[model samples]
Target: MGERANKRSFTQSGRGGRGQGGGAHRGRGGAKGASPARTSALEAVRILRERDAFAQDVMEKTVDVARLSPEDRAFATRLVLGVVSTRGVLDEVLNRCMRTPHDVTPDVRDALQISAYEILFLDKSPHAAVDQGVELVRGIAPRAGGVANAVLRKVAASKASFPFGNPAADAAAYARLHGFPAWLAARLVSDLGAQDAHELIKASNEPAPLYAAVCAAKATPEVEDEVVADLEAACAAPEPVEVDGARVAGCYRLAGGRALLDGRVKRHIANGCLLVSDAASQAVASLVLPADRPASFLEVGAGRGTKTILIQSNAQRRYGAQVDGYVTIDNHGFKTSLLADRASDYGVHLEEALTGDAARLGEAVGDRAFDVVFIDAPCSGLGTLRRHPEIRWRLRPDVVTDHARLGLSLLESAAAHVAPGGMLAYATCTVLPEENAHVVASFLKGAHGEGFELVPVRGQAAFATRVTSGGTDGHFCAIMRRKAL
Candidate 1:
C-alpha cells in the first residue's frame, strides 16, 4: 500500500496512434474491423499481464494515447477493467474448450478474454462477440483463426453455465463464480464467516464508488460555499457523506461517476480545491486526530499525502487550526517528495518530510518524541480489492503473512515515538485479521507497548469497515494511549 494515492484521472478524450510492437498482423482478421476501444482494451490487458503493472495505470496511459471517442473511451475502460477483474473465470471457461490451453499465445488469449467478458457478463451479442473475437485472434496469430473460432463458439455455448458449479456448497465454485482465486476465497471464508465472505466477494466485483473531499486548506469560510456550489453545478448528482454517525463537512459521493471528466471538477482538482479519496480512508484520518489537538504530530507511511491533508483537514474543522509541528516519514524518497508537494498544494505545512524506513524510526529522528504518532502501516491491500482488482489475482497467501510481520515492526518502532500521556494510532487498508487485529494484539504484548492502553475508535476496540457495493472501501484503525509517568 505504499503511495496509494487516489488520483482519479480516468477520463481522457483524444485521438492518437494505436499501440505497436506486438508483432505485425499476418492477414486481415478482426483486428482490421475491431473497434479502437476493443483494440486498446486488449493491449491494456496484455500490458497488465506481461509487465505486472497496475491495471488502472496501464489502462489510463493506454486510453489516453489511443484515438478514441468519449463513448469509446468509456467502453474501453469498462472492457479493460472487466477483463482484468475476471481473468480467472474467463481463463477457466476458455480452457474448458481447448485440449491444450497452454498452446494459445498470450496476445490471442488476451483478445479472447475481452470478448468472453462481454459475452458472459455484459449484454453483448454472442454472434458478434464470436466473430470479432476470432478476427482478433487471427490478427495476432494468422494460423490460429480456426482454433479461435472453435474455442469462442464453445465459450459462447457455455455462457449459461459460466460459473459451472454450485457456489453455495464449494469454496472453489464460489471463487470461480466471483472471479477470485481459490486461496483468497477460502481464506476470506475462513477469516470472516461464509456469509460475510460472500458479501465481500460479490461487492469486490462491482464498480467502486467515486468520492471527493473538499480541500479544507484551500477553502476558507469566505470561499467554501462558492466551491461547494461550483462542484454541485459541475457534477451530475453529488451527495454528502457521513461517517461514524456524523456528517463529514466537505466530503461527497459522486454518484454520477462522470464528474471527474467535467472540466470544472478537473480544474478543482488541479487547483487543490478538491481531492479524490475513499470515505473510509477519510474516516481513518479523522480517527487518528485526537479530540484535543496535539502540539506535535508524526506520521509514518504518509503516502503521497492524501491522508496527511485529510488529518489536517479534520484538525482544521475540529480545532480551528493545524498542528504546530508536523513531521512525516516514508521509506521511498520519491513518495516523500510527493507528500511535500501535495501538502503545499493544499496549503498544509510540514516541518520535515524525511525519507527513511518507519521500521528504523529511531535512527531517522533521534530522541524526538511527538504528542501524537500515526502509523499507516503497509499491508497486502486486501480490503481495496474493488478498486485494485488485480491484487486478487496477483496476491499470494504468504504475502499477507509477510505484510503482517512488516506491520508489527512498524508499529513497534512508531510506538517508541509516542510521548507519555500522548496517543498513538495505527491503520491499514486490509481487512485480514493477521494484518489488522493480530498485529495490534502482538504490539500490545511486546515490550515497546508496555505503557500503552487500548482506546476504542468510535466505540470499537478495533474499528473495521467492510467493503460495500456502491459505498466506501474497507479500512481498519486502532488507537492507544501511553500512560503518564
Candidate 2:
C-alpha cells in the first residue's frame, strides 16, 4: 500500500474522462501493464522539448492520437497538455520533492512530471501512478526507475496539502503556486488585475470546446440553421447542442475539443460547409473592421483561408454586395495552396490568391490596389494562451514587447495597395499591446500612413467590446481608414 491507502475513482472534470485510477495498493508486483497512451505521451513530450514541436502538429506523426481508444486518447491528451500547461509549477514541486532535481535525465524528468501530475492532481491510484512511473523510467533510462519511484512517493505523501495561499493577495506567489510563467503572471496582473488574473491563469489551463462556423460562402444565405441541424444529426451520442449569440452570426459550439470528435465533423470540414475555428478568431476576422463598403478586398497571411471565409461572409453582410475582386495572399506557397483548396471547397471565387512575403507585396501583385487590405499578422500568440499553451513557453519577452517590426514591414508594403477612402485592418491573436495597439499606432505615424485614421472595432455598437473569454481566443484588432481622394 502507498500513501493513498484507499482506491479512488478519477475525478469528474469538464475535461471529460473515465479511466480507472492508476489502481490501488498495487506495489511493484501489481503495477499496471505497458500503457500505449502513456508511452505515446512520453514521446510527444520529447518532441515538444527537443524539437520545439507544437503538440497538435507532432501528435499525429508520432503518436496517432486519433487511433487510441477514447479513454486512452483522453488520458494521453490530458497528460501532455496538462504537463506542458503547468511546467513551471511542476518544476517547482519537483524541486521540493527531490534533493537534486537538476541531476535527473530529461527522460526521467519528464516521467517524473507525468507521475507528479497524476499523484498531485488526478484521481489516479497512488500505487499505480508510482508503479507506472517506475516502469516508464526503467524502459526509457534503464537505471533511473528506483530514483523515479522514490521521488514520486515523496510527492504523493505531500501533494495533497499544496500551499497555494491567497491569489488576490500576491499575484506572483499565486502564479508560482499554480505553474504559470512569472512574466505572463505579471502581465496578467497588469492587464486583468489580481483576482481576475489568478482566475484567468487557472482558467486558461482548461481546454475550451471547439467552435465551428457555418461557411456561409459555401451554403445559401438561409443555410446556417440547416447546417447547425445537420451537424447535430451527425452526433451519435448525447446529441450535439446548438450554439447561438456567438459574436460571429454563423458560429456553433461543440462541447468537446475538435481533435477528439472527428467522426461526425471531419467530413463537413473537408467539403467546407463547416470550419473549425476559435470564436475569438471568427470575431477577429468578422466581428470588426471595414466599416465602409469595399469593392475589392485583400487579405494578407491567409493561412488555410478560415478567416478568408469569415472575411468574405462579413463583407457580403456589411456591404450587401459581393466583393468585386477578392485577393488572398500568404508568404508560404503551401499555405497559399491550402487557401486555394479552401476557397474551392467553400465555392468562393478569388480573383487572385498570391504567394509572397507580406513585406514584398509588390512582387506578387505588381503594385495592385484594392478597396480594403487586411493583415492578420504573425504575432507571439500571447492572447491565445487559452488555446496555445506551448506559446507561453516558446515565446520570448522581446516578441511580446515592441512587437511591431514583423507586422510593420507587412503593413508598410500593404499600405501602398489601399485605395483612397479604403481601410487597412490589422489583427492578431495576441494580447500584447506592442503587437496589437502599438503596431497599428506606429504604422499610422509612418510615411505611408499620413492620412489614415483608426476606426472602431465594433462600428456603431460603441458599447460592444471584443469577446475576451468563454471559449474565445484573446485577440486585438485595429481598423484604420484612409482619407478619401
Candidate 3:
C-alpha cells in the first residue's frame, strides 16, 4: 500500500463508506482502473481553465470526447461541480499544504482543487484521488508531472485544518468556503440580513431540483406524483414530487433533471402536457392575469416565451373567447420562432412577435396600444442562483450596477405603448436595488412628465415593500395610468 492511505470511497456515500476510519481499504492495485475515471474530471478542469467554460459545459463536452460510461459520466460531472463550488476553500487548503503557495499555476491549482474536493467533501480515497490527479497532469501537461505528484501528495497527507476558520464568526470565511464572490456575499448579507443570507447561500450552492408545471389538460397532482416517484426510483437523482397542482398546467415538480432524465421525462412531459419550469419562474408569471375579454396584451423582452405561455394559459382560462390579440416581442428572431411554436399549441394568434431591441419597442408598436405590457427586462439573473450557479463566476459587479441604465431605457420605450389606463409591469429575476426599485423610481420620475402616474394597485403591496410576499420572483411591477394624453 502507498504511504498515504485511501480514506474515501467514491462509489458510496453517507454511511459504511470511506472516512469511517475503519472502513475496508483497497490494495495498491485497486487504483489502476480508477486513474482513467479521474482523468475525466481532470479534462473537465483543464477545459474550464483554458476556455473559461462552465464546469457543467466542460463536463458534458469532455464526456463526449472520453466516451465515459454513463455511471462514470455522472460521477465525473459531480466531481467537477463540487470542485468548482469549493474552489476557494480548496485553494486555502492547498496554500497551507504547498511548499510555496504563490508558485502554483492556475492549471495546477485547478487540478489540486479537484483533488482537495474529493478528499475533503466527497467520500473518495484521498490517496487514489491524489495519485490519479498526478497522472492526469502527466497526460495533459507532461512537463508538470513531477511537481504535480509532489504537491498533490503533500496535500493529501496534510492533517491541518482549513485556514479561514470558523465560518460562523466570519461571513467572508463562509463565502470562501462555499465558493461565492465576496461582493455577492456582502450584497446578500445586506439584502437578506445575516441569518437568511447564510441559509440562502447554502441553498444556492446545491444543485437545484428539476420541476415541471403540469398542464391542466393532461395530468392532475395525483397522477403527477406517481410519475415523479417512478422517475426518481429509475435514477439515483430524485425528481420533484407533486406538492401542489398549478393553476394553469398540471405540472409536478421533480427532484432531478440531469440530461439523462430528458428522454425519460419527454414521454410524461408530452402525454401529461407538462413543461419544465422553475417554481420561482412560475410564480413571477402568475403575478398579473389580465381580464380576459377582448384585451390587447404585450409581453416585452419575451425571451423564449416562458412567461408568455404562462400569460396565455391565464388568458385561456379567464377570457376563453375574449382575448383580442397577444403580442410578444424579443430582440432575437430565434426566440420569436420558439414563441410562435408555443403560441400555436394554445390557439393564440400572435399579432406581432416583433424582433427589435426592447429599448426601441415604442417604434415597433405605435403609441398607447397595449392594455398590459410586461417588461421582463434583461437582468443579471441573480435570484436564480440555484439553477445557474455559473453566473456567480461570470457576473462582474459593474455588470449589475450598470444594468439600471439599460433597464431605464427599455422602460422608457415601453411606457409609450401603455394605453391610457393600461398597466406596465417591470420585472427582473435579480435582487439588486439598481435593477429593481431604483430603475423603476428613475423611470417613473421622467415618465411622470408625460402624463404617466404610478397607481397603487392591490396585490402590489408585496413589491412595494420589497418583500416578494406573494411567492413571486424578485420583481417590480408599477401599474401606471396615462391621464388622457
Candidate 4:
C-alpha cells in the first residue's frame, strides 16, 4: 500500500506525455463551464457513491438520455466507467499524491479522481486537468480547491504505476494492480489458474462486443442463411459487419462498430426480425428441450424477455408453430410489460405476461404446468462484468451464496410447474460455481429434484472453459429432463 508514483511531467499539446505546471500552457478554449463529459461523470460518480446506484442506469440518464453528440457521449461514458472501474486504483494513486489520503473530503476525492483519470489514462493536459479540477472543486466546495490543486498536480507529475508485483508471485497484489479486489483475484486464480484469471480480469475492463440474434418468425429450409442475407441486404451498418459464427447459428456477433445505431439494423430490430442478443445466452435458449414439439412453454424470471423470444422463436423454426400457452413471469410489472413489448417487437407472441414472484411460480401458473419451463435465475452476475463494470466494485463474496439460495429455491418452485416428461432449463449469467453448477448440484441432491436428470449444456461457452471464446460472458445453463409418466 506504501507504493508511490514516480514523478513524471507532461506537455500540453501532447495528449499523454509531460508538461507539469509549465509556463507556456494556457487555459481551455471553452468558456467557464466545466466539460460536459466531466460534469456528467461527476454526477454519475456521486450517484454511485451516495445512492448506491448501478452504473448503467445512472449513465443512461446522466449521459445517454441527455443525447449529447457522439464524441461528448463517448468521453462522458469513458470518464464515468473509468472512474467506477478503477476506483480502488485511483484512490491508491491519490493517496500517494496527498499528504493525508484518509482525511480527504468526498468532494476533493471526487475532483482528484476525475483529474487523475484524465491525467493518467485519458492524457489530457496536466495544466488544463489541474485548472479544471481546481475550478470544479471550487464550484462544489470552495474550501477544498487548494488540496485538489496540489494533489492533482503531484498526480499529473507522476507516472501512473498501478502497483502489483509479479502476478504469479502475489495474486492478491496482481488483482489490485488490475483494478479488482484481492479476494476476487484470488478466487479467479484459484478457479482458472493465474494466467487465464489475469486475462479475464483485464478483459472485464474492455467494452463487451455487441451481438444480434436474427429471430426466425417467417422462415424456410435454410433459415439461418436467409436471416443473414436479410440483415446484410439491409446494409445500414457504419462499417461492414461479418458474421461471427454458427455455434448457435441463429445468433451473430457484431463484427463492426456500433451497428445498433445503423439505420438498417434499427429497422430490422423494429421489424422484429432481429434483436440484440448474446450468442452464449442464445445457446442456453437452445440447449433446453422444450417438450418435444412443445405446445405450452413457461418462462420464469423473464427479464426483458430476450430468452422468452429466443426460446419461442427457435421452437417455431424447428416445429413450425409457436407455443400456444406461452406464459412469462417476473415480479416487477415494468419488466413484465417490457417482456411483452420486446417479445412483440421481435414478432414472438406471449400468451401471458404475468407479474409474480419467481419463487412462487406455482401460484402464478396455478396448476397449469407447461411442457417446458425455463428459469433464468437471478445471480451475482460475475459473468457479466464487461457490460456492467460497476458490479466489480459493488459486488461482495456473500452475495454469491445468497443468490445461489434464491436461485435454487426458484428452481424448486419451477419443478412444480413442469408437466410429465417435460424439460426444465436453469441458467445464470454468472461465472461462480456456487451460483451455477454447485446450485444445480445442491438441487439434485435434494428431494424436490429427485425425478430429474441434468442435461448437459451444448453450443455455449462457459466461464470455466475460458473467456477467449468470442461469444459469451461466463454463461451457465443446464437442461433437465423430468422422469416420464
- The clash count of every prediction, one per candidate, is 1, 3, 18, 7
What is the per-residue lDDT of model 4 for residues 269-331, given as tens digits with 9 covering 90 to 100? 677777666566766676664546787888888877878877778887767777788888888
- Per-residue lDDT for 137-197 in model 2, tens only? 7767767778887888887787655535655576665676666777878886786566666
Name the candidate, 1 or 3, with the larger TM-score value: 1
- Best-fitting candidate, scored by TM-score: 1
Deviation of model 2 at 374, angstroms: 0.4
Question: Per-residue lDDT for 282 in model 2?
Answer: 68
Against the correct fold, how does model 4 do in TM-score?
0.83
Q: Which residue pairs collide, candidate 4?
A: 8-157, 9-18, 10-17, 10-18, 10-19, 11-18, 11-19
TM-score of each: 0.92, 0.84, 0.76, 0.83
Candidate 2 residues lying further than 4 Å off, grouped into runs, are: 1-34, 62-67, 99-102, 123-125, 158-168, 235-247, 257-264, 287-293, 316-322, 459-469
lDDT of 1 by residue, 181-275 (tens): 89899999899888777888888877677777887777776665766677688764667898767677778877555667678777777788788
As a whole number from 0 to 100, the lDDT of residue 124 in candidate 3 is: 68
Whichever of 1 and 2 has more TM-score, that candidate is 1
Q: Please state the error at residue 86 of candidate 4 in Å.
A: 1.5
Q: The CA-based lDDT of model 4 is what?
A: 0.68
Which regions of candidate 4 deviate over 4 angstroms? Answer: 1-34, 65-69, 99-104, 119-132, 156-161, 164-168, 218-246, 459-465, 469-471
Candidate 2 clashing pairs, residues 3+ apart or interchain = 22-125, 89-179, 383-431
Candidate 3 steric clashes: 18
Compose the digit string of candidate 3's lDDT tens values, residues 280-337.
Answer: 4554555555444437888888877767765665455454542456788888899889
Off by over 4 Å in 1: 1-30
